[model samples]
Target: MTMRTRARTMTALLALAAMTGLAGCAPGPIVEDGPGEAGTLEVQKVNPADFAGQSLSYVYFTDGPDEAATRELIASFEEEYDVTVNLEVLPYSDLVTSVQARLSGGNAPDVVRLTGLTDFRADLLDLRTYLGEDYAEEFVDGPVKGVLGEYGEMLAVPSDLTLNGPFINVDLFNEAGVPLPDSEDPWTWDEMIDAATKVQEATDTEYAFAIDKSGHRVSTVLSQYGTALVGDDGAVLDEAKAVEALQPLVDMMADGRMPRDFWLGSGSRYEGANDIFLAQQTPVYLSGNWQVGQFADNADFTWAAAPNPCADECGGFPGGKYMGALAEGPNPALGAFFVQYMNTTKAQQKFIVAGGFLPTRVDLTERGVQYPVRQEDMDVFFADLARTPDLGYEANSQPSYTGASLELVDELALVVAGEKDTTTAVSDLKAKSEQLVEELQP
Candidate 1:
């Protein structure tokens, strides 16, 4: 058969698997004896046999650490089911826009792996029926929030959770004679800043601390302060706390505790301070779990995931990748089944270990992942993830949060650059958030 003919046949076979509306020939004689007269034809009920030679398309972001493991999982699924899945890889920046465009144009792929769900929620297939209630309840609270729809339907399953926390140069701390705090008794933000400042001064480093120029990472600091830039009601819950959360960052930039150029120079685009930390020029780096694998391989000095520092609370922001099926796809049923397969305990455990990812599954979170490298550092991040405040989840779950939060980052950057005061910047953020909420509301 020609490749084009084979493609058409595979598409029809997969569509017939779950759709009761499609009636046609397959490999041959898929129909069975049913309750109908001799001259009449009754459509056979859907069954697994319908998927025998079917095909599916899945979109995957290329930024993940365990691309090979993910492909292995897909290959296993295809081998077991005698089917095929076309994996379309895109960079993280292009994944959302491309998928959303396809969705709007009614050309979405069968399955997709994504981070933000707000824009795609309308197009996502509800997997509650296939995944079941008991299975859906197995996810940890914060990670699960990222996959739920407006009405609490499970539109996607979260995978490879990330948490924003600090990593410290253990060698620098030891060099400065500053003792790192024990895991059992973690220090507050103030104490952490003091230790970092001392280490920077003693070691003659350029900066004591550095954080990603991202609203998402900054939310970690905001959550510790018992607030977020935008609340569930599309406003700041504690305006005073929002100001307090941001003021320290502005001050840090001015005092050389942080690199002013990193924040001010990046404009509104997301930027990281990983190079400075990896070069041993900074005592502390405020990043996330995703960096562990990279740092483990590249950092010259001994580094470790530090205990999350507290202000009013002790935690970091929660975010993750999500696997979902597009409702408009040719084979949503097959797509959903694949999503379930990926979320199975065996698959999740392997993916976690291979990628050094924090877990979204409750059991995995409790049992832990024994990464081949830097297991202890991974433990610190997992510990902080368990303690993440609800505010972090609520703030990000808002449909307007992504766009508004980007604006918040740019506004705060103006404050860091001394172009705007904290009070005015925060007020502008609240106004911008409210405006976005109105514009984005369905």
Candidate 2:
């Protein structure tokens, strides 16, 4: 209700209050915190009045997170800014293509959405120019890089370094009589394949591995080799390195270790065959973090997170999501604000609670938020994310690199499809990828 009333609940000085209203439900109370929690929520401080009477259009990944509270917060911003904030959602695949077309056609949303690694690096306005001096550290580490151009300049503020990974059906493993690994003993590649093969042999499954040959899935395999899809030279992965990089995975398929057709083919239901896993037809799902919300909602079997299996030599893959800001928008400030807003500790709490996205902020992960109903579930994801090396980020593993890295994926498809031998595929991929990387390199 009243700000003063909200203040009574906080321990000390109250800088911000988040009031939520659910549809067809009574307006919920505000959650207020003392100083530094939300980094100055006082409307007077940021001057929501500055945004009044204006409409801000943000082009985002067509749709994500409709948590009533976030919408309520947007409404409050609208009321404060006196402007309508229109969110344009697009498919993850097409978000960039859409942004580029709009910018060229001059119909671009004021705010643009970018993957951590997929979108253009130089096209955005320099956020550091807007948030320079001392205000920058208030943001997370990943967003700080958004300003960094190809040679390293801050092009835009970061949205989120969303974590994506393998989803395991532990109950299915148990049911199929495959031994599940302990929390300490993460599965190795051979072990993962063996377990999947065993599950198929022991059950009436159509597929063992939840084949996803997308570059997203390949990141994990690349990581398993301690090889980043984009190398230190910042060129397309050496097709040789790319091939050698993904050798273990190709071998797994070649040896009849995992399902044959599912990954190498693009026709699978993109929403996930998690249903297959749910129905006990496919036991594992190699998917993004967003699927957690979907999984908890539909899964009937008792599933658990297994440390993503890795190559025998290297450890697990370091997962970094793609996110970015638009070059132009109806509300550049607010678009920037949303980028900041979504990546904040507060939003991360909601992510863990709502979508199971891993927090990129080390501080948040170490001192986790209490937003999720399933703390245990959050804890497991947090651990899964923590095991990843910081080197992945330093290696420039932003989701933005998805396109350039995909040259290798195209080659992998040929390998698995029997169109090309693994050796030739890797060798050819290395050459083509090197050229692409040279073109994309900073």
Candidate 3:
């Protein structure tokens, strides 16, 4: 099917386009205007005719609607510039390892799509010299920070933004006679559990909640409880906060409100909870906005995105991918041009609208993109993004947090599976994370 045709089909499948409120703590001051208002700089634009016959290679993962949108962008670029782009699409599972192998072999693609730039910063072309400092201001702050290196180098161009929260089975709530919380009034952690219990008893669902078995997803609870995977000095997860963050999942499992086999299930480390959710075995699923498209296209029951339950505060990990030029690539000029071109306002709007993604541009966030489907769910997601605490942004942007965060997930799994008590698990995690952070330091 054509890209536009597929988008239209996805839209048709998404018949529930009603706006929903998202609950969370208030956000810090944010720039509500477009990046153009930030500033302007006179930077040299790429003259496509300068290298009409030049060839460039680009690599990226293929998934969902993005693959089609990306190909459309490449076709437009290739046609306009009169250059040949050897586009290499890899499966999500093979993307990172393959890119690393190629880079190690000194045969890096001219431009590549990356989710995190920190590890690749040393080998990435610093774009500030080409795109100008002013150009960087055009994107949203959270994503910009994610692509910025420790020495203030622009390692990548931010292309999109995504945030995680709760997706509720609306029909189950109605059947359970539990009132949904509005954006103005979000439920606290205890309150959410109370409501989930009601839904479980009334509906006899196999599980009340099933969170994605990802460290990033679990970090939302840690962030909401006013802690991060890594602190300013080092790894600083206190026992109290650790228990406060992890105990709820443990308690839910003990009460039979959550499936013990999902996280601790007999499967690979990559096992997911999305299957249980899609089967309607769970009333709530804690995942990122990426699931919106899948739920829209595949769900047989009514559902809506809800604000994350708050403890001391409410927040979620800010995530998105970026396009970066390899410093060791065949053509730096072409790579830089493509990176900047792909993130331009027009290009971002086209991709965001076509791919059903949240825009990385502040202005696009405020003005909104014309998503072919799930517009209302997108609204709740944006609202949740706005309320996310600055600390949450800080946590995800740090490279050191990567290893520590994974350890947190593994250790927490042990706790959930009753392999280790919360105290022992937290202690071991704290020490290991601290060591990992120290080892990662330059």
- Candidate number of the best TM-score: 1
**Predictions ranked by TM-score, top down?**
1, 3, 2
Q: TM-score for all predictions? A: 0.87, 0.76, 0.87
Regions more than 4 Å wrong, model 3: 1-46, 266-268
User: On residues 1-442, what C-alpha lDDT tens digit does candidate 1 reach at each position?
Assistant: 5444644654554444434323332222221221111211122222344576999999998556688888899888887667899999988788888987887787889999887787777778767434432345888877777676544456789876888999999999999999986666678989998999999999999999999889899888888989886656776647688898889888889998889888877578998889989988799999998899899889889889988899998978987788988878998777877887788788998887888788888888888878888888888887887677888887777778788779878998888778899999988888888888888744
Error of 2 at 242 (Å): 5.2
Q: Model 1, 283: alpha-carbon shift in Å?
A: 0.3
- Compared with the true structure, model 3 gives a TM-score of 0.87
Best to worst by lDDT, what's the order?
A: 1, 3, 2
> With candidate 2 superimposed using the best TM-score fit, by how many Å does residue 99's alpha carbon deviate from the native?
2.8
Better of 1 and 3 by lDDT: 1
For each candidate, the alpha-carbon lDDT, in order, equals: 0.78, 0.55, 0.76
Native-structure RMSD, model 3: 10.2
- Please identify model 1 stretches exceeding 4 Å from their true place: 1-49
lDDT comparing candidate 2 with the true structure: 0.55
